[model samples]
Target: MYSWSCRFGLMMAAIFAVSSGQALAQTSAPPVKASLRLDWKGGGQHAPFYLARDRGYYKDEGIDLDIISGSGSSDVVKQVGSKAVEFGIADALVLVQAAEQRVPLTAIAAYYQRTPIVVLSPQSKPVTDPAQLTQGVKLGSKKGSATFQGLTALLAANDIPMQKVTLVDIGFGVQPLLVKQVDAMMGFSMNEPIEAESAGLPVTVMAIADHGVDAYGLMIVSNPDLIAKNPALVKGFLKATAHGLSDAAKDPAAAVAAVNNAVSESDPARETKVLDRTLPYFQSDDKEAHGAGWQSESRWEHTIAIAKKLGLVERDLSAHQVFSNDMLPH
Candidate 1:
């Protein structure tokens, strides 16, 4: 037999060769194809997905991700529930409503920790409180919207009768509010508020969450079929997505840059403002203590209760039935 040192050297070489081969195989394997549908057209709110795509986070998890712009959150929920796509980002309350209708959607991660709905009024003549919205106030309302649903919930919780204020129907523009056609309007804090401010119309924003109507906002959703059939893929996608969100939060400029690079029609300056306003809503007491995308059951239960009051859901739903924290990266 050969000396001990010679045998040990040969064994070491064999182990190195095996490990190298494994590493090469992993690097060379074709990435699995995946797609993500957004709640709306690409904007600053969606920068993390683009950032993830640009930084190869999905690729690192063997996922070839294609991000698709969508018409709306409800439409996205329908598409994902129908199994037309593997994943989607949508409003969490919308997901609960869909689930009540026997949709197969399950929220895998909480993207926004708080609702962004706000009552917008000109700062000169502000509607400071919900109680102030009584006296024949012409409240601009976009009916059949997620924010409208939130408005209804706020009214119910605060014991404000629907008849207390006159609902002025408006389209998806701030012109109605700017021209004093309506005293106040319901819109997202990030969208209409930013638009109004940019147009030199500073607004008095009353957040719904601050007025006893708290709820989880947008979330990452997937179907049970995908979650059951390919659990690893689900976990991998969440891991990559979480990393992308973390990176986006840390370097918003880079995130905006990545989004602009991907979408030719995107406006950088406007998107920058939107992203700046959006980043704060991503944090919560539970998120700070646990980690990103951590859902608190009590908070979710409260949201479901609000959905029930708004008649968005036909029946009661438990918080656990609509979401799962299994996929989030620890």
Candidate 2:
């Protein structure tokens, strides 16, 4: 027992045992087969999604959510609608648009309580008023983005014709404003603006929530057949998503750190700013009263009202046909 050789061997074995135990703990969870496609790249709005993966939130709820990047919200919705994917983090407006076309997808639960749409530009050439932008101001937005749709609604509401101004399809991010390609750009505030500001560019954001377009944002979507066949799975997804949002709200810096682990650490400061603004959407007066998940009555009615007024919907549809509160955890 007192021999140096024996002592050295025991010490090495103990070290190996501890290392092996840690490795097993980190790698023991079985891979789940769930597939989720996101319309946007990683950001604060995506923190809950990243949290669901990193913190074992989805796995704890018995789902192996395999979230992936997607081309756009329309693509995400189309894939989920076609049963090619189990879940999609997509715009709430896309569901309304799909229902208008009689597509058979349903929103199980919502993520952002407020839409993430925004008009990003430099403070020098800002679209301070939605109407003012059409006064020969150049604009940029993704071709089919929710914000682009809202931009149309905003112009209609303000009596500004779109053709009078420029509407360039700048893909994503704030390339137009940062590079001075366009006077203003419309996209996700928590995503593009935050990204632009972090990249050392002076950026100003006009969130649609602040711009009089307070529509519901990202929601969890699934095929209606899946909802009828396995409602429990949908409920679990919502509960986990809601829980992840709540946790992120309580400790956003740590939440961003968790997200940063999945993404990049170069922009933690900017990511936290976006998270702070985005968290309030998760808890509205209705959500506080109705528990978690999308509020079917008030929120849906407002969205439909806006869609109808903006001519985005042919006729008003019942909220029940589009969204359901039954999947939410009571």
Candidate 3:
């Protein structure tokens, strides 16, 4: 029989061997290949994902992510819903609309807690209040767009009649406003206003959220099938994305630089300004407490209400049906 000391040493040796083996296995495992389709082409708001990609956050979480620029939020939702891509960044309204159509997708995280829709007018003739929109003001609107829908909802909530304001047909870009084609335009707070400023036209911005048109903005989405089958992977993706968002929040310039590095045509100066405007939408009381990527049930409900008001979704939808905070990092 062996001495007590000898048995103890053998037991320690076995434990060490098992621990080392586990570590080796973890380090040796291959990363899961994942693809993320963005709502639109690369822009300042998309910097965090590029930052995370370049900083190795996703790699640290065993995800080899490929970021793909998309045509629009609706396209991104369809791509994720069809399993054409592993994940996507899209507008919350589009996700709800897609869900109503029997799409197999759900919002995993909210990128912007508040809507980015705003009324933009040149400083020469600024629209200071949404109430002024009813006083024979010409408003630029893109028909069949979420912005137009939001504008109508904003007007109705403020007790302004749609017939009172003259809405002019306009395409994307700030030219319609800059050229005085319309008195003011309904556009994204982070996008057109910045573009107008860059072109030497200072403008007044009336945020729709401030006028009781609150709705969730862009969100990260994934199909329910993948989420059900590989919850761990979903959790890891969110954790790594949260890491990117935290880093971006701490050093926004660095995040913009990452975007510049990834997209060949990016303008750093303009993107820096875009990131500045976009950052404020990222925070809320819930995110401050629950951590990044947290989704509020009430906020989702409010979004559904807006979607219903706009006739974007016909079916009844509970807040929980479209989003979950389960995958967010604690």
Candidate 4:
């Protein structure tokens, strides 16, 4: 896959240089091609990228995005690190952990401002406190998955030892929770919760955000090599993506329609339900009131602190070594 770009950087830089009374001789910039992989399965959650493609935002920027579904968070990190694709969406915790283990990856944009991880249980025996999740309870989720890693982080943060609870693997889908095979399952705030709701299963969504575990969710990541070699391509991808995501939030119905065109998993009724349910997770211009997609400096520091606490990052790791938003779209 090639790095995508619109060849706009040189022109913009030339304008700035000329304004300073500098004799800037400009050469024709070559077109650049870039490929992108997002962590999705053609569901309502991926409406933004779908809208962006249908609206030709990616094409305008010379990006040939090949959207792919990664089953787990680590997979996304691995794929991006190996330069398999230009960018992929993955959880922040997993990325942090992988980076600590020497995996090369960096987040470019934040999808959900809040962490979507949760300790789910029946509405009756809701696992509200960290103390209630004891050894007797059978928790169901997947290993190397965002939910499992997030649960691990949550437990560590709350001082709830993992040995106290019986962790069970439940694979990708939400079947284990729905069948009463497990007391509670760690699931997405928007996705699995909606799946449970659609099946008439009574469940309480205890958002990780509610439990003092705030982190960025669904970030765009790229290889360090690609980032260094072709920053303009990365910036173009982010700008087009921001445009697409912004459009998706304002008109979810239209977003779903575009998603339906590419994927059979997306339809009018089912997808509309998913869109409405997942809408709460999205933060937009209307919600943020001039908020941008970049990570706040203070928030980044807090995230680093969490990583250090969990030993997921080097205690001495400088923030400069971990990330570079110099290529991010403004």
| TM-score against truth, every candidate | 0.92, 0.78, 0.92, 0.78
Q: Report the lDDT tens digits of candidate 3 across residue range 219-251.
A: 999989999999988999999998888898899
Q: Which whole-number lDDT from 0 to 100 does residue 25 have in model 4?
A: 30
TM-score of 4: 0.78
Per-candidate clashes come to 0, 0, 0, 3
Per-model C-alpha lDDT, please? 0.89, 0.77, 0.89, 0.73
User: Model 3: which residue pairs collide?
Assistant: none
Better of 1 and 2 by TM-score: 1
Runs of candidate 2 exceeding 4 Å displacement:
1-33, 134-136, 142-144, 163-171, 263-274, 308-315
> What are the runs in model 4 whose C-alpha is more than 4 Å off?
1-31, 134-138, 166-172, 284-290, 304-316
Q: Which ten residues in a row have the lowest lDDT in candidate 1?
A: 309-318
Instruction: Assess the local accuracy of residue 204 in candidate 2 as a C-alpha lDDT between 0 and 100.
Output: 73
Instruction: Give the residue spans of candidate 3 off by over 4 A.
Output: 1-26
* Residue 178 displacement in candidate 2 (angstroms): 3.1
Alpha carbon lDDT at 275, candidate 3: 89
lDDT of 2 by residue, 1-330 (tens): 479999999999999999999999877756446787887667776787777677888888778887677787788878988899988877777788889998878877767777867777876666667767867777887866567788876766567787876777887666667778888888766667766776777667776666676678878788898889887777777788777877787778778887688775437877788788688767776678777665666778777777787677888798887887788888
Segments of candidate 1 deviating more than 4 angstroms = 1-23
